[model samples]
Target: MTAGPDPVAPGRTTTSSASTGELFGAVTRDLSTLIRQEIELAKAEATQSARNAGRGVGMFGGAGVAVHLALIFVSLALWWALGDPVGLGWSGVIVAVLWAIVAAVLALRGRTELRRVQGLPRTADTVKKIPHALQGHEEENS
Candidate 1:
């Protein structure tokens, strides 16, 4: 028998073989670069999301201001219409007082709602768990 062509020695390396240390260094470098890229992507997305949120808030504020202005104009028109028939000046004063009260109540309620909205936690729990989730996915894949 021809001794099965002399089985290659277990730890012997050919000229083309990469050392474990070099392989480990390459893998580490690649992983570091990948992690940095992911971090940058996350930051960019967060900034974009913040910008969108700001735009949305600005639009809401503009619409709210417009609606409030329209409400005041309509209230004034009603007051003027009522003035001639019912001692117009007193009617206007009474209407203005009532509208002011109503506006104050609405403003108070809005302030409370704004506080609630502002107090909401900004941190995303899902983002905190991403590394663990990725590890789980890798294990599953393996």
Candidate 2:
């Protein structure tokens, strides 16, 4: 069911109708602006987060290099210790074989850990549920 055009507006063209449409148009334009602003805000936040992550990764790399230098000294000490039992060449070969085995084990474990990672899965699931939550379709029947 619908109401007929206002009698005062005969052809449905009147100042009041035009004003109402103008209001609707204004609201639509404002909504579009608001959505664009929100998108820009999100983009800015994401950019900041990426910059932070890059800095963090670089810092970690620096730390890793420092640790590697420390490990080199430690390995040299271990080779010197074994030098008493075996000759220099055999001691170096033994250390090399031990490092090879350790590298293989670490590589396998690191691969497994990387495979287990699911980036932002919980956030993704929560975002997916937002529309349903906004529509008042909360869990009831389960």
Candidate 3:
């Protein structure tokens, strides 16, 4: 039978075999380089993601400013329209009252939502049980 090559030494390129120490050194160097490359890749991806997030935040800020300006113009237009029927002074007061009522309603609703928040109840429960769990005390199912 004509032997083609050594199946056990598939990674060995040299015709002369290397020592186990040399093989181990080569593997260690390759693994170290692979880990370094992976870390560098992660850093680059994180930087890119951070930059994208910054741009998105800037865009949102711009949109918010534009919306505020639009609301101001709309309020002014409504005030002028109402001024033709009522006096300009009464129209302004009417608009102010409407905005005040809107603010009050929003504030009350926001307070209610804040009150309803459970403040991570599940996380607190899990944290309290961590000491017991680590001590190998299995919790009985109720």
State the C-alpha lDDT per candidate: 0.65, 0.67, 0.67
Local accuracy of candidate 1 as per-residue lDDT tens digits, 44-112: 667766676677668768978889889878888888888888888888888989888987997887677
**Distance from true location, Cα of 95 in model 3, Å:** 8.4
Top of the candidates by lDDT: 3
lDDT of 3 by residue, 1-142 (tens): 4344457767553434566786678767865775576566556665766676667567756876888788789889999999999989999999999889977996786567446533344444544554565456737221
The TM-score, computed over Cα atoms with residue i paired to residue i, of candidate 3 is 0.45
- lDDT by residue for model 2 (73-113), tens: 98899899999989878889998988899779967865675
Count of clashing residue pairs in every prediction:
1, 0, 0
Q: Which candidate wins on TM-score?
A: 2
Residue pairs whose backbone atoms clash in candidate 2: none
Task: Candidate 3: list runs displaced more than 4 Å.
Answer: 1-15, 79-142
